[model samples]
Target: MKYRNLGGTGLIVSEIAFGTIPILSGDVPVLPDYYSPNEETAIAIMEHAFKLGCNLYDTAIVPEYGDAEIKLGRFAAHIGREKIIISDKSRYFIGDEMYDAVNRSCKNLDTYANIYFVHQVDENNEDITFGRYGAIDALNELKAEGKIKFTGVASHYYDVLLRGAKDKRVDILQGSGNILERGMLERIESEPLFKEKGFILNKSYAAGILPHFFRIETLLSGVLSYPISSVLVGMGTNEQVDQAMMMKTENYSRPSFSQVMSVLEKSFVPIPCDRCQRCRCKYGTEIHIIFRQYNYYFLGKDYWALRKLDLSINESAAQCKKCTDMSCMKKCPHEINIPETVQMIQRLVEIHIRKSLI
Candidate 1:
């Protein structure tokens, strides 16, 4: 396994970081799968990954990731905390809340996190997170106090991450990308501002759906082709650890967006959004995120994706119909029919919700 510097932090980490979501014992509905291995089993799986050279482990606080944080602390103690780098995060947006969250995470880990991110930052909470006494400030204070070595901003939206990149307080950025949704990654590659900060990419397998349509090496190679510090994969078993870590590193060319779409064509008509976040909604809806949920529903996250779509699909569709703005389409490089696609997804949600009731 090849090691890479995590930005300019001077910390060396494996190309593949261990994501602890799958190893958590719980019925986390948001998660794609529910494989709750016992503490002994979870430790063994992580230990296997460690032996395979995975030094960076990422987890969140309790209730968000269930007992995974505590389990990670136990594993850290078992393997000697100094031997590994821990990356922890919380969903709090306020300064006081975020500052307290980091302390709680330290207690859960039984040691300091190498990096602590303000996770899932988006437009709704972007102001509070980046504003005065926001989560970023809290992280900065924590860094000064020696609680966490680095401050990170993790978001699914490109704009949120761009702001984090521009902020001097942030040391690392975490985002999602895969072979199918490589549009954001493409944009990040073209922008020089992102090169100054470390990037850790998750959702490499599109929440474990792409693996069914494409080979593991294909997904890993495509995402790894970009300039990033690490690719986080949630491994639940020893076999999963092997599949994620043992990619053929030599002579693997990154697959083009067209090639990725071609493979998905065998399964279903995937929305060509690529999640660039170029389309802005005046109605305060996340158009790209909704489109992703539509694709995810068909890709095996049926109920979970549907539930997310149900939250704003009707309202967003209504907004799309009432508005006369066509800028969303005009700005789309793929020229996707924004209104029509939204209506189509709305119909999909209605159909699924109706069928489930029967």
Candidate 2:
């Protein structure tokens, strides 16, 4: 496995870190069965990955809750913890809740994490993350107490990551970057803060859409071409572990920017709204969020993605009916019929809600 320095943490990590979310089932409300492997298979895949030189393991609170950490801890004990790097994440927990979550994570993992992350902090909720008794404070306290060696922020938003990097408290920054999602790659290349901090790129398969080898190769090549520390892959099977190992040792040519763009365009699923933000609602409706949620739902076909959309709809859908002026449709760059799309999404949400009730 190719190794690289993890930002300024003085720790060396494999370029392809093993992400463990796909390995276990959980009680997380959305898509509980999605990507879950049996315990035996999960353990075997992880062990095989370790033997193949994948030294970094990342797990988050969602999807598997603490199950992934417990399994990882058992594996760590068997293989010797010192031989691997453990990365854990806590999502939206703050103050005492954050402390309790970390404590539980450590206990479940059976060792202090080498890197602990404030998972999924975004620009919209920056205050909740950086405010009093927020995730940052909790992470800082954990670091000071020596429970975790380093603190990092995992965000889908570049602006939030930039803020975290500038805070100087964060030792690592994790973001989603793939051929389909190249915004983070561009930000990392151009932004000094991203260069200065440890950057771990995840969602390389665009949340499991690009499962075919050819698509994976194109996406991996595009991401590997960037100057980042590590690219995380969710390997649920032995074949995937082997493929990751092979990719590291193989001399595959990286795809050009234009080629990557071509692939993305060819593979792209059409989402009518372009998120111009020029579309104004008299009732202050967030139409862009609806479009984004629908995009995720359409691409993933997973209930978790839909659940998020459901929540967004619950919050914003009411306002759409109140808008007298159909100004959003006029403002759309693609001139998409906004009202028709919103109604379609509303019907889908209603169907999902009815099914869940049944």
Candidate 3:
């Protein structure tokens, strides 16, 4: 496995960091699938990944990742804690909550995390996470206390990540990208501010859905082409570890975003939105994230995606219909028909909800 500098951290990390989500045995309703390996089996899988040159092991606190952190702690002890880099995270955004969360994470891992992130940050809580005595402040405090070596902000939206890039407190950024949802990654690559911090990308397979539509190598190579420090792949079985670790990251020609969309088009009518987060609704709706759920619904996350859509589609679609403003379309580089697409998404949700009742 090749290595890259975890930007400005001076720490070398494997191109493929081991994602600990799938190894946890739990009924995590959010995920469409999980491996549910026993504790011994989970540790073995992580250790195998380590032997394959994967030094970065990423996990979250209990209940979020369902005991994976504890298992990773055991694996770290088995392998000697000094040999690997541990990345831990929690969803807390308040200063006190974040402070306590990091301390809990350190105890769960039996060692301080090399980097800790405020996971799943979004526009709703971005201000709280970055504000005075917020999560970032807590992480900074933790860093000074030697509880964690670095601070990070993990979000799916580009605007939030850009704020993180601009903030001197943020040492690393985590986000999702894949061959299909490469829009945000494309925008990130062009922005110079991001180069100052390290980027670790997850959902390279779009939460394990894209692999059914595209080759794993295709998905891996597409995101690997970016300047990201590491691309995380969720591994459960040892075979999966081999499949991901053995691929040659360099010298592989990656398909363009259009080419990836074309392949996906053969399966279903893909929403043309790249999730760039540029199209803002005068109403508080997150347009790019709605588009992402629409695409994910067609990509095999029907239940989870539709559930997310149910939260705002009705209201957003109503607002789209009532509004006369066309600025969202004007801002879109792709020139996507935002109003029409949102209405179509509402229809999809209605149709799916009706079908499920039958």
Candidate 4:
């Protein structure tokens, strides 16, 4: 496996780092079958990743009810301390409780971590991540005292995350970006302008939705074109891991610009459902956010993001007939063709249901 320079730091992290979330709650519908993995399988997968030259592993303090960190640390211990570089985080406010959270991560990894991430950030709590009491100061203190190698943030909100990216003190940053969530991609040309700092690209599989519109080769091809130095893929099986490894090398190169454009041109627009409360969608349709559903279907098509939304538009996935046309799309900002998109999603949902059932 090839490695890239991490930010301005000399650390070389693998292109496909591992993310350990046994389960994700809220706005998400499906969880990977972490339950099916015995301790043996989990151990094997971790070992396999390392054997394949994955030097870095990322785990959270509260990884889906505590199992992930415990298991990860145990694996690290078995694998030998010198073989891996670990990164972990506390998704809490940085002050007061931050150090204790980090200590817990160190203990769980059974070794010291190289980078300690500052978890999540958004509009309401930008100060939580950027202020003196946040990860920046805390990390600086720790680094001065010889606790960790560097610091960074993992954010979900793009705007707030972009702010984090501007901070020179922040060593690394990770957030949601996928083929469907092209919003983040638009901001990437400025990546070189990060004043020489680099970010790690997560959600590369679009949380698992990119494969919908494009063929698997095409999706993986586009992923390698991202500007960030590292991209993480959560692999449950060895086949998935091997396929992901293929994205890093020159042997499996990216699709050409026209190849990308041609694939996008055939893409369908998202369904029409104004988030406005004026026209209602029955069957408990979240009239507002399903646009993300359609966007996920087309642009990024990350299954994890789609599942994260926890949206079930219809009873059987073919239930678009549950609502009449509210014409909410007519008032949208960009003059989007809304109703047609909803119908398209309805059809897609049925297809999803059928494929899953089979």
Q: Tens digit of lDDT per residue, candidate 1, span 19-117?
A: 999989876777766478999999999999999899999999987998899999999999989999999999999999999999999988889999999
TM-score of each model, paired residue for residue: 0.96, 0.77, 0.96, 0.71
- Model 4 misplaced stretches (Cα beyond 4 Å): 22-36, 63-65, 212-217, 247-290, 296-358
Task: Name the runs in model 3 displaced over 4 angstroms.
Answer: none
Candidate 3 accuracy as lDDT: 0.89
Candidate 2 Cα misplacement greater than 4 A, ranges: 29-40, 61-66, 212-214, 248-358
Worst 10 residues of 1 by lDDT: 349-358
User: Which residue pairs clash in candidate 1?
Assistant: none
Task: Please report, in order, the local distance difference test score of every candidate based on alpha carbons.
Answer: 0.89, 0.73, 0.89, 0.62
Summing lDDT over every window of 10 consecutive residues in candidate 2, give the lowest-scoring window: 27-36
For candidate 4, the per-residue lDDT at 112 reads 72
Q: Give the distance in Å from residue 215's predicted Cα in candidate 2 to where it truly belongs.
A: 2.8
User: Which sections of candidate 1 miss by over 4 Å?
Assistant: 351-353
